[model samples]
Target: MSWTRKDLLAMRELEAGEIVLLVDTAASLQEIATRDIKKVPALRGKTVVNLFYESSTRTRTSFEIAGKWLSADVINFSASGSSTSKGESFVDTAKNIAAMSPDVVVVRHSSAGAAALLARELPCSIVNAGDGAHEHPTQALLDLLTIREKKGHFEGLHVAIVGDIAHSRVARSNIHGMRKLGMTVTVAGPPTLIPPFVQELGAKVSYRLEDAIGDVDVIMMLRLQQERMTAGLIPSVREYSRYWGLTLDKLARHARPDVLIMHPGPVNRGVELSPEVADGPYSVILDQVSRGVAVRMGVLLLLAGRKGGDGG
Candidate 1:
């Protein structure tokens, strides 16, 4: 694939072949992170600006490191420090930034269609880091890469995504990407927490944690999204954990002995997952984080690099 798109907005819009290309490109570039120099001249003069309207840890840092490793000039802009907090509209601020000529603008906003709007308005390539509860494409890409590394393939692999599905951008993106890649996805959460018509996304819905964990190939527990909560989704964190949390006991009794445990972190230590299960042998949480950087690097290289440049 020659990579014709100017933006990488959501997994829902990507072809199955495009997804495979991204994973392959990331795997091909993983060696750079291990090398002594750890630098690539791939995007030597390209500039990438990370525009985040919300708070972040992993996603923000990963994009910065990825751009720096690829030798792109990387800048970080957050709402607190930027004109956004001063009542500047997103489009106006973004236009001001674009006038400076960045090669790519990676955005994370609290509005669902922020990235799509930016893609429509900006001349630079847009990468959706996250947009409200809509999608986190790079997170899904790294998750698929990790799963492929562990399971050898995506077809027929049962991935049970547990917790906070209604507000989880990771779950939304993963549902689309995994189904497109031929995996069976089951979203498990409290009835109030699971959105209506989610099954239309080609994923099965489950209300029982016990049922969701049973004999699955992957058990991905999501952090309880407290920040995104507007209504009472659950009575309390303790109650949600009692029903849905992945404990050592739960895994031992119901989950497969070889089932991979994954969490996109800033983990709620005892709420969504227990300490033992999170640090246990089958856990690939750390692998997911490491693969995140590689995945972002591949995305930046693909979207920011000139389509005319050396068969990109």
Candidate 2:
């Protein structure tokens, strides 16, 4: 497989075969993740920097673990705890890190395309963790892995992604992954929050929650980015819940008894999804997090030119 030099800034950059290869490779690597000696010699002596300008717990930690499992030294650079909060530019910051001669730099920032921009300037490989409501390719890959594990395959499955599409990098990534895997995807939310022409990306767009949920194979609930919210996007939590929220009763309308439910980390509880449905039998939210490490391992290995093919 041939991969371009640009970092995987978005799912639009991936082909179907690449997605399958990454997920399959991740499944193989997951077997070794629980072992007493989990480290691999694939990336030995390589340094990988976790440069996160945005806040995170799961994505950052999983990437760090993935780098360690591959036997690469990990350096974490957080904005809040580092010099970045003091008004340093991304390019200068990246150049400083590059001066240290790292093999790969994994970054998450509040601005879209930050990773791609840095990739062009640095000699090292760049992995995008999440970029400002633009894309989270790795997160989407892990979510796809979880869904396929629970539902056998991706072809012809109806997947409904509910909530905050305009502000969710995860939602964009999921749409790309679902379409690549041959699943039918739908973005459901209030018209204000959903992006325009989302259907042009091979997804069916919907404005009603109950209608989109009916008989789908998977239901993906995106986190409402409270930190990114501005005035008028949403009126109030209670009011927003009434219109677009996924209550147990709302989910009941779409029940197939085997319909898989999914969500990304740090849930907003009653705001976007009800607690009952989130922790219920159908939810694969926790599994998504668990599969993250393996998927990340696959990504790192692929980029480092290991056993598997490169993602070009």
Candidate 3:
């Protein structure tokens, strides 16, 4: 299938073949990182703008490096230092950026429909780095790539995603992407943290951490969002850790010997996973980070490298 979409706004909106194509593209580009001169001319004259309304270390930097590696001019914009801090509306700021004529605008915003709004308003190709509790498509793609690299396939694999389901965009994107590609997903967390209608999104909800991890091929632990930890979502971090946090003992006793451990990071250390488990042999957390660049590079090439692809 040829690439047709101008914007990647959400995982739920993509077809299974589209997802597979993205993962395969990223897989082919992974070897570029090992070259003596880590650069490619696929996007030589393209311009990618990282328009971020929220603070990010991994996603923002990953896009910058990805564009640079593909020989595209990458410009990063932060809301804090830009006109957004001086009462400039999101639309106004975006319009100003659009006038400069970028090939791709990778955006991360605090609003759920921010990327969609940009797709509607801007002529440039849009990539959603993340939107408020909505989706992070590239993160899910890199995760799929990492899984394929490690486990060799996606069909019929069971993945247990544990922690902060209600506040996780990564979980939402992963659930949609994985289910479309024939993987089973079980989202596990406290009842307060697990959204009521996750099953409607094609995921099995489990309250017990042990029950969720047992017999699964992959265990993806999510970071507990401390900012979103309001009045009653969780009683205490200590209590949550004791019951829900993944430990070496939990892995040894409950999870399968060949089960892969993963996390979309800025890991909370002892809250979502123990230090030992995060650094353990079964953990592919670092692989996910490296795959992030390759995934972003693939996205840039597809969306910006098209013929007659000129943006406002």
Candidate 4:
């Protein structure tokens, strides 16, 4: 199928083939990073704007590098020092940026539907970096690319996503993408952390970490958001670690020998993951970071480059 979407808002809205096309495209672009020049003209003459209402390190930098590597002009926008601090509304800020005629706007906001709102209002393609607890489509796509590279396939593979599910857009996007590609997912966390109706989203729920990881091919640990403590969701970091934190002992005793460990970063050391397990041989956290740039490049090429060129 030809690339037709103007925006990538969520994995739930993508067909399985569309998801596969993105993964394959990312795979093809992985070689660019290996080259010394590390630049391509795929998106030359195109402009990408990163409009972030939230603080970020990984997603923001990854998109910037992706656009630059593809030879597109990239602009970085932050809400803290911008007109947003002077009470400019999101729509107003976005419209002001859109008036400059960017080819793509990659946005991250605390509001859930912010990306969708930009998609409706802006003439440029909108990529959802992170939208409240709604979705992080590129993160999920990179994760899918990483999984396919490591495991050689997606169908019938089982992934256990553990920790802070209710507050994790990464978990939500991964569940939707994985299920569509015939991968089974199990979400494990405290009952309060797990949201209602996740079963309807095609994920099995497990309260215990051991139970969830035992037979799965991949164990994805999510960040334990600090706000969860203030929100009274989990009792304490110490207590949560005792039950949910992944350690070498836990992996040795319960999880499969070939199981892959993954985290979406800014990892809370000794919180959701032990030092040994996080740096262990099974961990592919770093691979996910590298794949992120490739995934963003693929998305930009498809969405922005297609407008004027073959995007190859």
Candidate 5:
């Protein structure tokens, strides 16, 4: 299939074939990391800019590494201490960066459609790092890559995603991607944290963590999104943990022994997951981080073609 889209706005808009292509492309590029030189010239001379409005560690750093490894010129921009601090409008700030003629602009903002807004206005490819609680496309892609690598296939797999669903861009993206690939997704969380009409995305909702985990091939634990929380979503952190948190005892009793445990990171330790479980044998949190670089590399190379194999 041809890759025509100049922007990756959301997983919800991607076809199943498109998602598979991305995963395969990234897999082919994974070998570069093993080379002694650890560099590829596929995207040399192509300019990639990170335009982030919100704070980030993993997403920002991963994209930066991806661009650099592929030999692209990478620039980073954030809202703090920038013109946005002086009351610059979001569009105006983006427009100023657009004037530099980058090949791709990777953006993360607090607004749901922020990446889409930039895609429409900018004359370059846009990769959605994240936008509000809407979606995180690359993160979802990397998760799929890991699962596929581990399980050998996605068909007939059950993935249970647990935690703050109402404001989880990760959960939303995962639901869309997994369902498209024929995996059953059950989103388990407290009622208030589960978004209304989430079933429209083709997920089974359950308020019980045990019920969700009992039949899953993979257990994806989501972080408690405190920053995006509204009032009264949960009675308290302690109470939420007591009910929804993934503990060793819970997993042993409810989930499959080989069930993969995953978290997007900056985990709240004892809150969403126990430290034992997070660093235990089932966890793939670190692999997810490593794969982000390759996934972003694939996205960049696809959108903005290589100068040449040697980056000439």
Candidate 6:
């Protein structure tokens, strides 16, 4: 089968067949990550550029590690110390990077559609690490892999994604992926934190998280972006937790001992979810981070294709 290059901006871009291929490939790559010699030859000689217009350590470092594991040459760009600090536009910076002829560009920027904008102007495939509150597709993919490894299939499962729904790109992407995989998704948070029209996205919406917690198959919590907190979108962490936090009491109300827990990392601990819940048997949070490396490798190799063999 010919490997078609996939630009992973959102779960909407993934078809069933493609999801299967990517997941299967990622599972195989996971085995490689377990080996003493962690590197793989699949993307030897490729050039992978990590272009970030925002600050991050986990996502950026994960992408860089993924690229290096596949034997790709990697360049990590930061906005603060780079030419972007000199007032260069994103397009200009992308064009300049493209001049070096990278096999793929993994971009994360503060603007919602920055990666898509870069995709339109660049020759290489684009992997949207994140783009504002718009989407974080790979996070969704890795989450899917984590759930699949545990629950086997998403169909017939009830998933409750609690916390900041309005501003979480992870939640947005997970909603799409879960629905596509035939899971029932319910988003729960304060009225202000959830988009009023969230049901239009095929998810059941609830103002009180308790309403959606019962007998659910998965509990997905999102990080509370401090920027959102400072914006006063959420009144205060104490108030936010009272209304939306996944406390021990909340988990008990769900009553499903097997209800798998998940979170995209840099967890706020006592804020979004309790420390006990995060470290509980139900939590696959750490696995999500580990799987991130493999999922990114799968995406990078797929996008790079045979062109990666040239080390461009």
TM-score of each: 0.96, 0.92, 0.97, 0.97, 0.95, 0.94
Tens-place lDDT digits, model 5, residues 71-127? 999999988543455798888988989999998999999889999999999988899
The weakest ten consecutive residues by lDDT in model 3 span 303-312
Better of 5 and 6 by lDDT: 5
lDDT for model 2: 0.84
Residue 206 of model 4, lDDT score: 100
Q: CA shift at 111, candidate 1, in angstroms?
A: 0.7
Instruction: Give the CA lDDT, 0 to 100, for residue 266 in model 6.
Output: 92
In candidate 6, what residue range of length 10 has the lowest lDDT sum?
303-312
RMSD of each: 1.8, 2.9, 2.1, 1.5, 2.1, 2.2
Q: How displaced is residue 252 in candidate 4, in Å?
A: 0.1
Error of 5 at 127 (Å): 0.5
lDDT of 4 by residue, 1-312 (tens): 768899999999999999999999999999999999999988877889999988998999999999999999999998854345579888898999999999999999988988999999999999999999999999999999999999999999999999999989999999999999999999999999999999999999999999999999999999998889999998999999999999999999999899999999989999999999999999999999999999999999889855644444
User: Lowest-scoring 10 consecutive residues by lDDT in candidate 2?
Assistant: 303-312
Better of 3 and 6 by TM-score: 3
lDDT of 2 by residue, 1-312 (tens): 554443556777889888888899888889777899988877777788999988898899999999888888899998854445578778899999999988789999888888888888998889989988888999999988998898888899999998888888899898988898889998988888888888888888888888888878888887776653465787777777787778788777665778888988788898888899889888888888879999998888777664244331
The candidate maximizing lDDT is 4
- Residues 134-217 of candidate 6 have per-residue lDDT tens digits of 899899989989999999986888899988899888988888888888889999887778987789889998777777778688
lDDT of 1 by residue, 1-312 (tens): 867899999999999999999999998998898999988888888899999988998899999999999999999998854446678889999999999999999999888989999999999999999998999999999999999999999898999999989989999999999999999999998988889999999999889999999968999999897653447667777788898889999999998999999998889989899999889998999999999999999999988774666223
| Candidate 2 colliding pairs, count | 2
Better of 3 and 6 by lDDT: 3
